[model samples]
Target: MDELTLRIYPSVRAAAPDLETPGLAGYAFARHAWLQAWADTFGAQAHIEPAIVVMAGVRIQMVLPLGITRRNGLRTLEFLGGIVTDYNAPAIDPDFARSLDATAVQALWRRITAALPSHDVVCLTRMPVTLDPPEGAVGERVPNPLALLPGVNAAGQARSVTFPDRYEALTGTLRPRFWADTQRCRRRLAEVGPIAFVVADDDAGMRALIVSLKRMKSRRWRETHSKDWFAVPAFSDFYDAMARIDLPEGRIHGSSLNVSGTAVAAHLGLVYRSRFYLLLIGWEADGWRRFSTGRLMTETLLRQAFDEGLRVFDFTVGEEAYKDDWANALMPLVRYDEAITARGRFATVLMTARDRLRARATQVAWLRRIVRWLAGRPLA
Candidate 1:
């Protein structure tokens, strides 16, 4: 109904001056404070270029927090938060978003992409089909406009569990055997000593728990021979800063499962929009492994979520087998990739080939062994 124009801003703050206003509606990750934290920590390496869509040359309609980086000699455009951000979507005005249909959204997307600065490839990932309204907002879920565009493909699935009126009712939804096993684990863990689940209530406590989480996670990654993103200073810094961020609708939540006054497992997450996002989790790997501390930690968190009147407990991304035991719903994630130059197309082909190879390696043991041998890495 109104003329739309796209403008590029060099930073997240410049793009949305009213970022902290309660009127902003979007997921927690798309919040200005979240994106700005990423920009501040990762700005040394990536260039932050956020695209803002304006309505009637006055009102801000949407903000696409994008960034550019030179990888393998080609400048590439992508969402600002990269792999750390679970759900990537634009912070759009709800009224404007509801007015646009698929056709109109696609046209607007094309215009936005065309106006972007010169780059080789545009890759936007981990977008959900629909966005839940902010905490206390009264409305149905809004359709994610980017998901309606062509060329989007299924990236993966994010798992979550919706809470019931009662915590016991939520537990009843799980398999009888699984719940029994979780309870057994709790009993076994308590035998070691008094078991308690603690949440960080102050900034000092939050930072301490985050530090413990990082130590445990890094150790686990090292033992498994996996690529440790936390080893990267920027990645670690981004998460550390996020743990301290305080927003009206969202706040960093850190908790630990303690045994005998010692924390054996820790989790760093976000409490936003009546949901608890299970982001980073780590557990003691030594003697506590036999007690299943990780599962116990998760159970404690779920109970706390219920007590707090949270609507959902989101496991975020990945298809880890443990998620299947507790997840009652799975949200499909999608990505859009487009190449603007020969280099970009070549990169795209390489990515596809690599994915295929990885998929095949998972199925064929010999191939996997050979690949590992060639790469001079041990099996994970």
Candidate 2:
């Protein structure tokens, strides 16, 4: 933990470390092995921004393949937060994880000073506290996190709700009327047309449904004049592959809400460790006005899950109103960032300046409208 006397060096490669290492899951996503996959597949042009946090004659942690971009002459390094990956903390031993924060902070600062010695800005986005703060003013940049993280420590969370057992336990949290309404929706759906279910397995039928869902989502986004998550080819592939990722390790349950043998809505979720995490969803535009395709799809999945004996049903991060009816528990997602060096400090300052201006603009009702409109677009 002292002045990293060990000759630790930094590399931008994303290779996997020893399996016997302490925190493999934490660093795997950020390592070269994972980042290269993202680079090749996601076209995530990045620098080989590498750093080795070594100790005890072994390589403990490695940080690599981060995007280093200069904006307005500010040399800023983003934490990457594995934009295309997840689990962005250091992988070290239990004992080592305890001392990792301090060692990592010093090592990171040294690397930033050495790599772009003149650059005085490091901007870490959506980083876990386990990564350790660089000891300065910390603030939320975009406020709403770019990605969702399932916080295990929901007890301390303000919006935390109790986790319900799968099946009735979840829907039981809602009003009795809500359950009756669900029954009514089912009856109405039956009255209007036949309802069917298509699950994404390895079969051609499943693959076809996934493809149709993608096309449906793309068209929906275009008609609404909004950007879609799968607009990029890599993301589209990710969406498709997602339907397959859990099948081998655990189980993947991607369902299509169909009517009269025709697909009306689709629910794409990842089922792991007896928990169903709602990922992305799509619906047929025509049926939306008649019957809430999205919510109905949830009911479909919920009943299916209960029948299958699944325990937890996570709606993921958003505090969206619709999730309330089915979510027996509410988990509030939080955002926090830390600057680790002279580089981090300056970047934080620049963000502060920009956000202040935005905040003032939002103070005026009329101006707020424009601010929201512009923000929906892209900001450098």
Q: How many pairs collide in each candidate, listed in order?
A: 0, 18
Superposed by TM-score, candidate 2 places the C-alpha of residue 120 at a distance from the truth, in angstroms, of 4.7
Model 2 misplacement above 4 A = 1-37, 43-122, 126-166, 219-225, 241-248, 307-309, 332-336, 340-344, 365-380
Which candidate gets the maximum lDDT versus the true structure? 1
Supply candidate 1's per-residue lDDT for 4: 62
Encode model 1's per-residue lDDT on 1-380: one tens digit a residue.
Answer: 43666667766778556455455456788777787788788764565555544332456677677777776567778877777888988777777778788789888877777777788888888998877765567888777888888879999989999887888888888999989988898888888899888889998888889889999999989998998878899899998888878766878889999998899999998898788999999999978898889998998898888888899899999878999999988889899888889888887787777667778999999888766765633211
Give the lDDT of residue 114 in candidate 1: 77
Q: How close is candidate 2 to the true structure, as a TM-score?
A: 0.66
Report the CA-based lDDT of candidate 2 relative to the real structure. 0.52
Off by over 4 Å in 1: 16-18, 47-58, 346-380
lDDT of each: 0.81, 0.52
At residue 153, candidate 2 shows an lDDT of: 26
The local lDDT score (0 to 100) that residue 211 gets in candidate 2 is 83
Best by TM-score: 1
Worst 10 residues of 1 by lDDT: 48-57
Residues 1-380, candidate 2: write the lDDT tens digits: 44333332343332334322333223234444334344454534334243333333344433323345554445555544245543334443334444334346456445534654344455444343332111121422111111222222221211212344545555667789977877777778888787887786666766777787787778878987978767777777655554544232235567798787888888766554345657567787765546767678877776776676655565654455777666555333334344546655666776787677688885678867776776645334
TM-score of each model, paired residue for residue? 0.89, 0.66
